[model samples]
Target: MNGDWLLRGRDGRLTVYLPSGEAVLCRAERGPGGPWEDAPRTVGGTQKLHPGAAVGQGADRYAHLAAWRPTVPGESGLVHTTHFRPLLAPLDWVPIGHPDKKGDRTGPPAVAVDGPGRGYVFVRNAGGGVSLRNQKVKGGWGGWLDLGGQEIEERLAPVAAESGRVELYACAPGAILHWHQEGDGKKPVRAAEVEAAVRPGTLRALATSAEHTTVFFTDDSGDVCAWRPGEKPVPLLAAAGPGPVSAVRCVIEGHDCTVLAQRSASGRVAFAAYPTEQESAGAWWTESGPQLPSDALVAVALDEHEELVAASLSPSTGTLLLTRRKDEPGLALEAWREI
Candidate 1:
């Protein structure tokens, strides 16, 4: 996968980038009936799954992006070492197949929890209905579990890997399913139904935080709402600041603090933080939208100590990047620091 994740507080700026380094969907859905912004949420209302369309012949198709370090900051520098053309499945021994035989899968997205291959994957189709595929890396990628529910428009699946298990989540109209990965040797794990806050069938964003995973929903007001990991989700909190929030991220150890990054309809990067405590959800979390050099912020991340680290904001093309501490080289990456 050429794209990398720029994690911010669940209430701050968020974005996904292509291998070429250009970004897309960096903002949230604008006013009602609007197209998705260049921000980080999935495709919707005729929008294509990004990074995927960007991948074609001679293009680097991200086979799958794996690995995230939530506990450490330094580890954040390189979250995923993507597999190029000769795509390498995480485990070589496991048998692989396209969960989306219809080629609707925006590449394959799966959740592996526990060991090498004990998770479920929900692949998409343009006509509607998702193909649920389960597999045990050790055993084999189980068969595709057909989870036929009302289709969700512009839905992107997020997965979790741990405890020799994998979980797949998707949204359709009014219900959610906890579809488990199964195989020939293994029977399908019963799919559990859950509620998605707000309208029954709006596209939601999901990400895993080590052992826990959270789902985010963009409400009618265009404000971002979230659900709890592992358990039934409850409304957490709205990101603070005057601008609307675009995306939410959970920070891990040795990494940046969890962030909520928002971009206004006009194009501005607003950052917020996801609370370590559940009580913090109701209140608007603290937010900061420092006037950045760029017209848009492509990515946002926090360091372990909760200090804001790197952000791919619209750089002042005419401004010269000075030395870090007045002595650092003009070399990229090391040239940025708080003034």
Candidate 2:
């Protein structure tokens, strides 16, 4: 199978979702850079599954997952878990929403968690509309609500701001469209589009601060561009990588930092970081990581200790490789080690 994986590491464990509808959960007893003492366990392989997305609820020690599936024949829908703990699996997955019988899901659904452990799922319908579902604080899930936009492309990703606002982004014919319910529940969904000069691939969003929420994507020109709130898109790296890019917000050295990882056309996978404490749009990107196979799928995240870890999937051999980087007192860039 042509597999896609979404990985998340937190609270001394890593959760990996395979395209075949299986989730492999691992526990890192010696921490992220150490060996996974427990044997990885797999769950849920009965149905066809799309790639999955995950987000952690800060301080609650819980993570939420959302993945698209055809639970019923000819019906494209979403399966999710609200009280998911990576180290503990065999979850009771719940069906939240589905497309109309005449319509189908156009792409993978994205998931994000707010400060209160509330989860949000965003998916694009075949009719070119974006559908969203929210997990209520008390219990159960809310109904599928239309965010309302025309010509919204198939692929979309959701990012939850620290301020409890969730933003959804999609690429259109000539620009990228973003929709969000900014304030209270009564407000209508706000929509905006940035006229980017390049086509986007694998879009990722991060709410860096109250002042700046950024979206990063791989452009058609094999470069990484950042789109800040209310501003035009700018190039973060000029032709730095090929293939795909992944970005996440994490705490690094007591400051909130944006970590970007990419695989180049030459089969080399590397990462860069931009700290929020710095004020330059022309920020420097530090590269550190072992090279991965050209065909490998890559993912990056911070462990419980806030250290950086990168993982790659070699589909041909079914091998998953992980690399970890440690920051020292005076080191500019630390070396990456395979775990």
Clashes of each: 52, 0
lDDT per model vs. reference:
0.37, 0.60
Most TM-score-accurate candidate = 2
For candidate 2, the per-residue lDDT at 261 reads: 72
Off by over 4 Å in 2: 1-10, 21-33, 44-61, 101-103, 184-188, 250-256, 277-291, 329-339
Candidate 1 lDDT over residue span 184-244, tens digit each: 3243354565665444333333343445555555554445565554466555554332332
Query: What's model 1's overall lDDT?
Result: 0.37
TM-score of 2: 0.82
Show the lowest summed lDDT stretch of 10 residues, model 2. Answer: 1-10
- Please give, for residues 103-122, the per-residue lDDT of candidate 2 as tens digits: 44566676766666677777
**Error in Å for residue 121 of model 1:** 5.3
